[model samples]
Target: MGIFGFFILAAAGYFLYRNYFTTNTYETKDERYNAARAQRQKELDGLLDKINRRGMSSLSERERQRLDELSGK
Candidate 1:
């Protein structure tokens, strides 16, 4: 290829790589909050399952407090 053609191909490749391979992490405050809430929900579900199988008495004090805090009580 000619020099001009080579530079054109290089620029196109650079732009394509930047668009498709770069990480996008531009979360708004609400989006970040929702993601955190989802994670907490997953954790709470696991804890609740443990309580169901083993009874509430099986939960450590820290785990029970976390449950109360998460349940908004």
Candidate 2:
């Protein structure tokens, strides 16, 4: 029973650590930049969808500039 209790407590602690204490640690600048670029691409895709459904006018100035910057236009 003591061994079982220790295993249960260890499992719980492991889960808590994973859920609350883990941090993203990139190994290199390129890795971080690629992650950021992918996130921006996701955002740009969402904006493009919005533009398709509505129009360019639907985008705020900040969003439009972001789109242009991402597209290198």
Candidate 3:
């Protein structure tokens, strides 16, 4: 029973290490930058659309700050 429990713990540790510590080897720096830029653009577009539908006053302070940050203010 002791050896069985040790093996179980070792397997769980290895699974956690593999999931959290391992980095993706296929993603290059440029790829990561492009992905981030695209995501920012998507968020900016959504915020702009919301403003058009409702109004600037509908945005929360955090959302306004995020919009400014994404827009490079």
Winning model by lDDT: 3
Each model's lDDT comes to 0.93, 0.91, 0.93
* lDDT for each residue of candidate 3 in 3-61, tens digit (9 for 90 to 100): 99999999999998898789556889999999999999999999999999999999999
The Cα error of candidate 2 at residue 69, in Å, is 0.9
Evaluated at residue 36, the lDDT of candidate 2 is 96
Clashing pairs in 3: none
TM-score of predicted structure 2: 0.58
Clashes of each: 0, 0, 0
Q: Which runs of model 1 end up more than 4 angstroms from their true locations?
A: 1-21
Candidates ranked, most accurate by TM-score first: 1, 3, 2
Per-residue lDDT tens digits for candidate 1, residues 1-73, read: 8999999999999998898789586789999999999999998998999999999999999999999988889
TM-scores, all candidates, are: 0.67, 0.58, 0.64
Deviation in Å, model 2, residue 57 alpha carbon: 1.4
Residues 51-73, candidate 2, lDDT per residue (tens digit)?
Answer: 99999999999998989998999
